[model samples]
Target: MRDAEEARTQPLGPQGRLGRGSVAPVLQLLSLALFTVVLVVILVKVSKVPSYQERRQEKQKIDKEMSQLKTGIAGLCRPCPWDWTLFQRNCYFFSQSKRNWADSVIACQDMGAQLVVIKSVEEQNFLQLNAKNKGPTWMGLSDLKKEGVWQWVDGSHLWFSLSNNWLPGEPNNDGDEDCAEFRGDGWNDGKCRVEKFWICKEPAASCSSP
Candidate 1:
């Protein structure tokens, strides 16, 4: 027995080859590599996220597209905007604020619409009924350009013989009244300098009612 201490050969592991000590190091290296790969994947995914400004811009673009879709040819199924009334396939807005005739015209134009255009007795009646509750309101009819020759905001001539929705003693052209106002009696030419609530009219989305 030559040196019993060295005679007891090191205990063998699986297959009695490299032993358990060598296996542990290999497993550790594999685990480290796997962890590194996972970390790298996570970093790359985080880097791909959009920035705050980029995300905001994208949202703004989507919002613009949605607005166009709501007002364009595809909007046939959509309804009138809020605070507007729908009648005869048209949308009418009754303003709560008061403004002079010129300013009222500007206000309506700013909203992508014009002052109410009363084309028929039916339209006049509709406006009259709606304005009954509200105070006196402004109409699109005016003779500012040429006295006694009334024209609509759309530049169409007003044919009194056709609709004839005017007060008996109105349009007297009293005190240089060029603008028109709608009252419970009928329409009357009023001073453009005087402020009054106005009505706005536009084509409603062509939605078929269920």
Candidate 2:
């Protein structure tokens, strides 16, 4: 009995010590691996956070620039030749030489604008009042696509009753004249081939400062 108990106790001493020693190494290694995994995950997240922040900042700057552009019309870096012409949030070009309606439209498009499309009653009045000296300038209004039906070159409807700005019997589609011209009172039908002054317009909001 004494010998068996001693044998059993001897086995327990070595086995317990070995198990404890082996378990400590395994736990240490497992902890190190877990810490490495956690560190790698944190590093990846931190790196991506900066990229997201940078993109957000860039978007804010773009929004600010757009707002600034909206509030103010681009200022003149150079003097405009049409001294009497009034322009707001836009650039205007009065044709120096005469051209047919089609040619004038093409020229305006080449300059990155269509013929002038008046946006408001005030704008129409302004154009008309100034156009007397301009001698009936070609406007954006035309029946080029569909005869007898008027439409702005920009594809907007001309609600005549809103501004009520039109000459007597205006847009009569008289004869072969399909093009429209702006005068002091309002508009008049005219021949496209007829030589007259023309207006080119570009939005000021879109112009970048030099």
Instruction: Report the number of the highest-TM-score candidate.
Output: 1
Give the local distance difference test score of model 1.
0.86
lDDT of 2 by residue, 73-102 (tens): 555443333422337766677777778788
Clashes of each: 0, 0
Write down the TM-score of every candidate: 0.61, 0.55
How far is 161's C-alpha from truth in model 1 (Å)? 4.0
Tens-digit lDDT track for model 1 on 1-210? 667766567665577578767888999999999999999999999899999999999999999998988777653565678899988888899999999999999999999999988777777788988786787899998998998999999999987564467778877998999999887867878999999989999999766644
All models: lDDT?
0.86, 0.77
The runs of at least 3 residues in candidate 2 whose Cα sits more than 4 Å from the true structure, single-residue gaps closed, are: 1-86, 161-163, 205-210
In candidate 1, position 154 carries an lDDT of: 97
- Please give the range of 10 consecutive residues that has the lowest summed lDDT in model 1: 70-79
